[model samples]
Target: MEEKKSKFPKWLKISLIVIFVVGLFIGWKAYQTFMGASVTDKEEYLYINSGDSYEQVFAKIKSLDIVKHPNLFDYAAKAMDYKDIKPGRYKLTPGMNNRRLIGNLRGGYQEAVKFRFENIRLKESFAGLLGKNFEADSTAFSAILNSEEIAKQYGFTKDNFFSMFIPNTYEIYWNTSPDKMMARFHDEYTKFWNAERTEKAKALDMTTQQVSILASIVKGEALHVDEMPAIAGLYINRLRKGMLLQADPTVIFANNDFEIRRVLNRHLTIDNPYNTYRYKGLPPGPIMMPSIAAIDAVLNYQHHNYIYMCAKDDFSGYHAFATNVAEHQVNARKFQKALTDRNIMK
Candidate 1:
């Protein structure tokens, strides 16, 4: 090595030094481009909508203000041949480098969103909720919900279409379509009404829809889950005895005035079919979307001689049950007195 150095010219030594410097610079640049901190925050999200172009997706990423070196990201993305940007909700976590972020986008590794609905009282409200969660708008969802022809394809009428949806939290992509959402609900409804549940409904002499209808009433009556079965039994007894359901929730629904804290004698006179006090049988449909617990309560209703239920006067969200008119009237009077004392006259 000493002999070679002796033979080497000064220019050659300078050239070698220059080459080493250039190589080091190139290596550093490559490292920065490939493994640098791209996501500047602990977490970020990117929503690429349907039919979004690559430029549009890049714009959305820029708008998030999470990218530390957007130019490097652009160069890396182009070099990796990432032309197609999949539409979905993408979550970018901390310590993600440029290469990792690009890989996630190129591979369409999106995060699923939680979609949940319970105690939804109106089809319109349910539609709005679904629209907010997915790409479909409220009008689009409402159209499908109101269409008898479309509902019939799933073995449901427009009036009873709500029965097809079971209340639960579902993990789904944010871009799910309305039609797909409806199909999913139908599949879930079919799976929920399995042999065991169906057999139980049969024993009760009720159809799946009938169970849902009664479940809605039970849910409206009972604020406490423990009382659901008792409320279901009371309603069942009333149904069997050819008595009016006399459910105040149904009366409130019929009036379309949820603000009426006290269901007065005037509210019961509403001519809407949802008023159980006026209607002989179950309402034209469920006044509200019933939960799985409420539905099961109807299927496994407690056997008892109690044919009446009045909300407890203590306002403890419990009810008092009675076997006859005298006891029921006494319970009703106590509750009425409590309401009057509170000056909740409506």
Candidate 2:
């Protein structure tokens, strides 16, 4: 049998090669699609804040509905070999791929909530603001404020905590710890105490506590910021002589009740260290949170011989500053009439 010489068509062989290449391409495309689907299915907004663990982070992502499979995030995170990732609040987006989301989570991408500080009574308010979103106890915070142990780091004793806080709107992380938040406040107060402020306090023979005490009085007595400086100067002038700083706010602080719309003669007789109407100098400590304006007013207090001030209902929102008691009484009587007529002097 003669072996027939095989005649192969060149186009047919080329066609087979083309089919193999196309098949390979299709398989690779299908694999890519599967991988993509594993990542891009969920939309979420989440915050991986400080002190969050891997499990906690996974839970948050799941809550955001960004990742359908928490186990996949866990596996990917571990495979990436990240331990103790720096955590921050993050705004997760819809259909974010898993790898990219993991990268963001590990990079400490955070979404910050604006937590503003308001009328706080020393450290308790700080704790309340921060603790509202985190673990914070007001009583424990007050203990730290009054504790010499933690305050030593700021170069002051516990006795100075109340004076150190100046009421202002502060921006802080929603999850900031109580201690860290307090430190931030300490820094703010320290920055406010410039050389000029210190020199001014010294010139007035007032310590930081004394200034804060005066500011608190100004805060309580004056209903508006426009009247703070005048009241501050009134107290300062009284201090220059041997007169008592007879501020009504001190009595309220002593009583622990802002009730008693009027501080009567009997209220002054009650013995309390904070009763400035009875004592000869500033109160032992601040009675309330003082705004920065009040603090500034005391530091740069106006120089005057005015020993008394009474709210003058001239509709100008100002008090009549007087050098003598007789003029003060006349103004006081006029104010008394306004209060009685308005039924404000209950």
Which is the leading candidate under TM-score? 1
lDDT of 1 by residue, 40-159 (tens): 783467778989999987886677766777788888889889898788888887667889988988898988888888989999999898888787689999999999999899987888
RMSD of each: 2.3, 5.7
In Å, residue 37's CA in model 1 sits off its true spot by: 2.2
lDDT of 2 by residue, 1-346 (tens): 9987558778888998999999988775543332333443454346556677777767766676666566666666787665666654555665565666677666765656555554555455665645565445566566677788777777666655677776666666545667887798798888888888889889888877778878888888877887777788889888878798888788877877667775667788879988887788877677777778888888877767789887786646578778888998999888878877777753
Query: How does model 2 fare in lDDT?
Result: 0.72
Candidate 1's TM-score reads: 0.94
Runs in model 2 deviating more than 4 A are 1-52, 64-87, 92-97, 111-115, 121-123, 133-139, 152-159, 169-176, 314-317
- Using all chains and alpha carbons, the TM-scores for the candidates as numbered come to 0.94, 0.76
Predicted structure 1: clash tally: 0
